[model samples]
Target: MFVDLLIGGIFAMSLLPLTTGYCAYSYGRSFWLWFALGVFLPIVSYFILFALILRQQLDHGQRLLTEAKAILAEAEEAERVQREER
Candidate 1:
C-alpha cells in the first residue's frame, strides 16, 4: 500500500505545474480559489495518473498474450518435428 501511495504521490507531483497553471487561469484573482484547488488537485491528478497507468498495463497485457501464443506455437512445432524424427 505504501508503494501505491508513493506512486500516486509522485504522479500527483508531476502534474503540479499543469494544475497550478489551470488554477491560475481559472481563478488567479482569488487567493482562496487557488488555495482550494491546490488542496484538492493532487487527489484528482493521482486518479488521472492511475487511470493512464492502468491503460498502459492493459496494452502490455495484450502484447504479452500475443508473445505467449507465439511461444506456444513454436514449442508445438518443435515437439512435432522431434516426434517425426523417431
Candidate 2:
C-alpha cells in the first residue's frame, strides 16, 4: 500500500511539469530543482513548496486583478461622463 501510494504520487507529478515549473519560476528558483523534486519526491515536495510559496504569488496575481478592475472602472466612468456631456 505504501509503495503504491508513492508510485501514484510519482505518476501524478509526472503529469504536472508545467505547474511545478510555474511554482519554481514564481519563487525565483530553478526549474530543474523543482522538476527533480516532483519527479523524485512528488507528494512531500509539492505540498511543502506550493503550500508555503504559492500564496505570495497568488496574492500578487490578485493585486494585479484588482488594479485591472480599477482601471476598467475608471475608463467606464470616463466614457459615461463623455456621453453625458453629449
Candidate 3:
C-alpha cells in the first residue's frame, strides 16, 4: 500500500508543471519560470506566484496614485494662477 501511494503521488507531481505553466500564462507571467518551479517545488511555487502577482498589482496601483497626485497638483496650480489674475 505504501509503495502504491508513493507511485501515485509521484505521478501527480509530474503533472503539476503543466497546470502551473497554464496559470502563469493566464496571468501574463513567465510560463517557463513557473513550470520549472513546479517541477522542483510545486507547492511553494503557488504561493510565490501569488505574492509576485500581488506585488505587481500593488506597484501598478502606486503608479496610478502618483499620476493622479501630479494631475491634481497641476490643476491646483492652474486654479491659483486664475485666482491671482482676477
Q: Which candidate wins on lDDT?
A: 3
Question: Per-residue lDDT tens digits of candidate 2, residues 1-86?
Answer: 99999999877758766567678776667888887877777677778777767575479886687679789999999999999999
- Answer with 2 or 3, whichever has the higher TM-score: 3
How many residue pairs clash in model 3?
0
Best by TM-score: 3
Query: What's each prediction's TM-score?
Result: 0.33, 0.43, 0.50
lDDT (10s digit) by residue, model 3, range 19-79: 8887888767788988999898888887788787677668978668767978999999999
* 1-86 per-residue lDDT for model 1 (tens digits): 99999999877765664565464544223444443555677566445544544565579776687679789999999999999999
Reference-based lDDT, residue 34, model 2: 82
lDDT winner, 1 or 2? 2
Tell me model 2's lDDT, rounded to 2 decimals: 0.77
| TM-score attained by model 3 | 0.50
Off-target runs (Cα >4 Å) in candidate 2 are 1-13, 54-86
Clashes of each: 0, 0, 0
User: Against the correct fold, how does model 2 do in TM-score?
Assistant: 0.43
